[model samples]
Target: MGKATGFMEYQRLQEASEAPQSRKKHYKEFVMHLDDAQAKTQAARCMDCGIPFCNNGCPVNNIIPDWNDLVYNGKLREALDTLHSTNNFPEFTGRICPAPCEAACTLGIIKDAVGIKSIEHYIIDKGWENGWVTPQPAAVSTGKKVAVVGSGPAGLAAAQQLARAGHAVTVFEKNDRAGGLLRYGIPDFKLDKNLIDQRVKQMEGEGVVFRTGVLVGKDFPAGITNWAKETVSPETLQKEFDAVIIAGGAETPRDLPVPGRELKGVHFAMEFLPQQNKVNAGDKVKDQISAAGKHVVVIGGGDTGSDCVGTSNRHGAKAVTQFELLPQPPEQENKPLVWPYWPTKLRTSSSHEEGCERDWSVATKRLEGSKGKVEKLIACRVEWKDGRMQEVPDSEFEVKADLVLLAMGFVSPVQPVLDAFGVDRDARGNARATTDGAGCYKTNADKVFAAGDMRRGQSLVVWAIREGRQCAREVDAFLMGESVLPR
Candidate 1:
């Protein structure tokens, strides 16, 4: 929809990044974005596929072709509006999302897909620079109140939508600030904290209330109370608000159990990543865990593991090695069979490009240490056959390791919060809530609902935002009898 034959003439181009040598010296964003003209040319790569699979691929269903055409035609303002119509935070998705839309692009069958994510970043950044992004306060007030229990992307999206639907929305965060994982879990080099602060300010201007350091549950633990600036029980919230949305993210991290698991040098990925982020935010940390001058081994080959790799390089570690239990995926996918769907293929993140050794189909058998601190890892190579994994004979080996970080993902949202609200959980440990029509996002308890990772388990920020927005629509409808908010 951008240009009749633009896809045939142009190739996809993306932003450039600083050299690893230079970028590893600090923890800040190093990618260089395209200028206005370059961005428009990239937008021209969008083709008018009869059926746009890219729309279905996008979690928020962003109007990709329409905005691409607008940008290609040099209609910057309209492009931003169309882009924002479906997604609330293009900036976040642009920077962090895996860009499934690009994977589903019509041209991707034979040629490189449109640089949709880059264009998205350009459109939103340009919108901000030109003062196009502003608060859209609701014209009418419904006088209903909504209590959202998390300040992650999902919780924030839901709260913003409900507030714009004329409902009084208050977001409760257990951390010292809002933007849960965005504030702490993610590295600043990938997404700067200032971007989050900017959107938060805009949300405030739109009449959303943010209460940081507040926990919601019964008999709030004294330890948690001290951690938060304020505290409120679920009962208190039910008594005060018309409806409650539980959007807290999955906080129970999966752990690696083996010999020397209690070693002093071993830490969870969450524990390691957040300290660096807090330090970047000007918070003082005593004797911060330094990968510097040490051999670091990161277990779990997901985004969290990649994050550890990047941070370790930034810390000037002597060596960094990442381990994955599954076998390595194909370097490229067979497009004919996997088109329009996310496929099983190797993905190399920018963090991977920074520098680190990656190994797959290997399992850690145990940890070895002295003085109660991790000193090495005993590992074995495994082979997959008949849908089961078996260790290869004589493949057992040991590698020196001064520090170990487990990035095995999360099991579920904190149990106490779910228990306090009396919401049922699925077999996988996620809150039991469906996204379909009729009782969408509704929890087992009356006047209670669930969304985001808490309801769906670990997922991308884009998916979380989508669920949050859809859940808000359901909550608004339940409170006001009907809702105009988009799902």
Candidate 2:
């Protein structure tokens, strides 16, 4: 605790954001990080809780109090070191992760929680600015080779750790670029693509090879996002590498199979999102899905849906509306009952602030259109009782919708990759692998392991990194019969 009385003396100050009206005009990050002094003040708010719940709350188990104290004492380099110890990509989490750590903070039970995410953003940005972040190449090279499939957060983290452990690592990505969701799924307005590029350059300098546009399984289905210019067989990887780790994330999106789902204007959120990211990166897409001058209806109330709202606004849509089948949560959570744990509460994203009409407990019945183009949506209100939903009588309604984006989240990993390698799948269709025990991360198949979203199903980037680091340790031990890498 840098300042025992800091909480009483200071009020929480959030990082400033550009006005929605102005920020929506361009596809760039708008939230400004706190300056050094402000960050120090924020860090000082960390209390002397006997057990730091915030640490446990974070998926990667970051040492929050230590870093907060370091930042409060103006030890910028020390804070950055502490942050990097737990999180391989704090820059990504700082920008995008919903801070469950803050929700579990002791201070949040009474007053506002410490602005940990903002402080982390400041620390990492400062580290980069001071040229402190550089490749840490291994001192000696091991003869072993490892193959990491999917260049998302999990694969990248595993590759970095395995390479630093003196093993040869090669990452294969289906996309033309390194980052998976970070490069394409997320809008540039929240995260800049250059940050991903910067890390890729550093990883390359550390002896980790990145093979972009290389698919490692059967060809992906049409309308699914794929930028692969070459295909590599799973058998080849198993034969060439000492071990193979699958981190290809859950790519099968959940679909609404109601009437008129085949309409031309209806698309999955993934189908619409990646195209805009490609356009932002200066690639010309043919017949790109545009929301311009249309009444857009985004189904599913989640980050992906919010992203659609933001992108639609940027596209200068006539109107934007979001729908959620579940009932709305309370605006404020009951802290007394849910302290030190993530609570159910309403969250309003920056996209909603920009412009969006949001409704909850509403379900779509069918879409009506002509000439194979969606024109309107038919929906009804629902009531939930005893964990079951029933439609409300005489509550049917219709709304104009020229474009419908289904952002209802992913169901499981794309099955073809798992089939190609002959790995068993969990009941949920994710790659089956335990996170603990002697065979942790090892799949049913020999010399193959699974981690991140591929094994755990779709999850946060922080969880992906954690799984990656742990899987790397397991793989290293499998290769050398023991491992010195951190868990």
For TM-score, the strongest prediction is 2
lDDT by residue (tens digit), candidate 1, 147-180:
9999999999999899899889999988887898
Worst 10 residues of 2 by lDDT: 219-228
Give per-model CA RMSD.
Answer: 1.8, 0.8
Q: Least accurate stretch of 10 residues (summed lDDT) in model 1? A: 218-227
lDDT of 2 by residue, 1-487 (tens): 9998898888899999999999999999999888989998999899888789999999899999999999999999999999999888888999999988999898898899988899889999999999989999999998999999998899999999999999999999999999988888899999999999999999999999999999999987655689999999999999999999999978899999999999989999999999999999999999999999999999999999999999999999999999999999999999999888889999999999999999999999999999999999999999999999999999999999999999999999888999999999989999999988898999998799999999999998889999999999999999999999989
Residue 77 lDDT (model 2): 94
- lDDT at residue 263 of model 1 (Cα atoms): 88
Candidate 2: lDDT of 133? 91
Listed in order, each prediction's TM-score against the native is 0.97, 0.99
